[model samples]
Target: MTETLRARLARVGQSYAPHEHRPLAGYVAAMGAFGALAASLAAAAKVTGKPAPERPSLGDVALLSIATHKLSRLIAKDSVTSPLRAPFTRYTEPAGAAELNEEVRDHHSSLKHGIGELITCPFCLAVWVATGLTGGLVLAPRLTRLAATALTATAVSDFLQMAYDISKHAAEGD
Candidate 1:
């Protein structure tokens, strides 16, 4: 049955984009997984008798925005995190600020290629990060806020460090 479904999907994909190696199957799977994750979070909340907040506070929203930005970049581009992405991406170059450039690997399986693309792009990873963080906010608000605050602090520190470097360079040039 799985093989038959795959064959039918391949035919449909071919009909849709004969010239492009589009990973429609992979995208479908990814979307299904995300849906499942969301459902699981909701189920857990119900099981625990936790109520969702009526609305997130502005401060929490700002904190989460910065935290998500930092985390998504860390996961997708940080040199230290390359091992996690190594299977899906090829090292291309240094991207400065302790970040690495990578290109998604072309695998025989379009699913793998699609996943690689997802893991390698910070913008793409942000949606997943935000979802997880939002879920965490509901499931464990204290822990989530603590973690988000730490990430936000680190992001602020990074900007300050860069600014200091620029000032030092300007002084030296003079």
Candidate 2:
């Protein structure tokens, strides 16, 4: 009798018990990919004769940080992105519970699980988004600033909308 691949993988996963290492391994892989991407971008910039800035401006950093934050949240939680995430994650609603709806990874494979984790976590995705936005700033400053401005404006609008909702509720209570 020969041990099947699935069986072998199951045994290995069982050996790792609680499976903490899986996520760490995924993170390591993601970091390596990000490093490679950054390197490639740097090489491309050099080839194009685009010199790297000595230091990014404070405004650029601020705009990018805010945009990254907004983009991450939108990707991780916005209903508009649910279609994109649906393949990797499942939505869960608790019965009679006041807790917010949640999305959890379907965990069919290590790669899928890792991608699901990255997509669902704003903090994890922020690093990648910020890197791309920063690279854009170097490669196409005007377009990057334009997109960042739109994202920043949307973020502000979201805050104002929430505040108005809260104030309306308070006024109703009063």
Candidate 3:
């Protein structure tokens, strides 16, 4: 009797055990995807004869980094995306001082679990977002800067809102 493909895959999965290897596999997959994207973007740029900037200015990197960070957080935690994320994650009751309710991976499958991990983790998503924004900067500087500016402004607004809430709470306590 021959072992079926599914059986072979099951055996392979078992070798990785305890679920720890799933995330490593997922991350490796993500990096491969990122590399492929970067290569494609580079080819497109070359074909279009778009000149690469000699060097991205320090300020441009700073703005893009902040905007990417903010956008990743918004996508990962904001209620607006809860519907999209619902299928991928399990919701838990918010713990003390938790601004956004906890949503974790359901771990239904390695692929789904990997996607859930990427979607829920700001740090993981930031790499993708930053790459996209950086690509945009190269492809369309004006438009990219406009979008990044708006995101950065929103980040500042969020900080101000948090500060105001803290001050209001302190005032009430005093």
Best by TM-score: 1
After superposition, which runs of candidate 1 have C-alpha atoms over 4 Å from their true positions?
A: none
Per-residue CA lDDT of model 3 for 49-133, tens digit only, reads 8878899999999999889988898777777676777777876654232335655565645556677878888898898899889
Q: What is the C-alpha RMSD of each candidate to the true structure, in Å?
A: 1.8, 5.0, 4.0
Best of the candidates, lDDT: 1
lDDT of 1 by residue, 1-174 (tens): 277777887898899999977777777777877899889889998999888889999999999999999999999999999999999899999999999999988787867887888888889889888988998999999999999999999999999999999999999995
Which lDDT value does model 3 have at 101? 60
> How far is 59's C-alpha from truth in model 2 (Å)?
1.1
Relative to the true structure, how large is the alpha-carbon lDDT of every model?
A: 0.90, 0.76, 0.77
Clashing pairs in 1: none
Q: What's the C-alpha lDDT at position 101 in model 1?
A: 96
Worst 10 residues of 2 by lDDT: 94-103
Q: What would the per-residue lDDT of candidate 2 be over residues 1-174, giving only the tens digit for each residue?
A: 134644555566667766553643444457778999898878878888888799989998899999999898888777667777778788775322121234557565666677778887889899888988888888888999999999999888888887898899999995
Clashing pairs in 3: none
Cα lDDT of candidate 2 equals: 0.76
TM-score of each: 0.92, 0.81, 0.81
